[model samples]
Target: MNTNTTIKDIQIISLPRIEDRRGNLSVIEKEVLPYEMKRVYYLYDVPGGAERGGHSHIDQQEFLIALSGSFEVVLNDGEQETTVSLNIPNKGLLIPKGIWRELKNFSSGAVCLVIASDVYLEEDYIRDFDHFIKSKNS
Candidate 1:
């Protein structure tokens, strides 16, 4: 884990929006993200007041967008914490490594789209908060 990482490293990235008579379209090309995207996934059907994501990544970085409805992401960087809301399709939250994140307050029909820098690797995740803090401080 990166010990120097903080909440300020998180960024709000805006995708290019092309408007047309029919509807607006957003694009995510190679230059959009800091790293090359290797995997993509989405989360949906979360019951009201239910929460997701209680872990911090050791190496993987992720970009999360609210494709539908809305949700709040609570981020902690061992010394400080903040909450960000995602309710737009063309905007995304870019989360770097070594920060703990929790997704909550999901409205009905909310869909969270995640674009990741790496594939699913269980060894890359630090799931416990105490262990996460220890790793960050060490």
Candidate 2:
């Protein structure tokens, strides 16, 4: 974990929204993120009252968008915490590495689109809170 990083480092990035008579479209280009996107995935069909993402990344950064419904992202930085609600399709939450995060309070039919800075690696995740805290202190 990066001790210098805190909850204050979390950012909400807005994408370009082009409105048309038929519908609206949002685009995410190379310049939209601090890191190059190497992977993409989404979460859907989440049951009510359930949660996801109870871990912290070692070096991976991610941008999450609520493409359909709404959800709350609870972020914790060893000593501080914050919660961000994502509900707009054109807006996203940019989460840097070293911050602990959990996704919860998802509305029915919610879709979470995630653009990752790197491919998935099991060793890159700190799955335990105690371990994450220790890494932050180290």
Candidate 3:
């Protein structure tokens, strides 16, 4: 796995939106993302001032989008950290492997959509912050 990745590698991708008189349309293709999406999931009904996603993946990449309300994604690479707000439907955040991420400051009725590069695997997750930092140095 590539453990050399940093917070600098994370990016906010803008999807193509077609506006119309009735409604708007947004599109996402496999070629536009850095990795092919294999799993898709979403988080909803989160209470206000709650948090989620306090772990790092070993070999999986992810893209996070706010489908409804707004939230904040805090990313840390064991050295530096940054926070990004997700409130737009056409915007998504790309998170590479080997970085620690925490989702917080969710508004009421916030819906967070996530796209993963790989399927669910418990072994691929670094749930502990100390272990994640140790793995980054090793």
Clashing pairs in 2: none
Q: Each prediction's Cα lDDT score?
A: 0.96, 0.96, 0.93
Clashes found in each candidate (C-alpha, N, C closer than 3 A)? 0, 0, 0
Model 2 spans with C-alpha error above 4 angstroms: none
What's each prediction's TM-score? 0.98, 0.98, 0.97
Candidate 1 TM-score, true structure as reference? 0.98
Compared with the true structure, the alpha-carbon lDDT of candidate 3 equals 0.93
Give stretches of model 3 more than 4 Å off: none
- What lDDT does candidate 3 reach at residue 23? 89
Candidate 2 lDDT over 8-125, as tens digits, reads 8999999999999999999999999999999999999999999999999999999999999999999999999999999999999999999999999999999999999999999999
Q: For candidate 1, lDDT tens digit of each residue in 27-103?
A: 99979999999999999999987899999999999999999999999999999999999999999999999999999
Q: Which whole-number lDDT from 0 to 100 does residue 47 have in model 1? A: 91
C-alpha lDDT (0 to 100) for residue 92 of candidate 1: 98
Backbone clash total for model 1 is: 0
Residue 103 alpha-carbon offset, candidate 2, angstroms: 0.2
Q: What are the per-residue Cα lDDT tens digits for candidate 3 across 1-138?
A: 338898889999999999999989999899878898999999999887778999999999999999999999999998999999999999999999998999999998899999999999999999999999888888
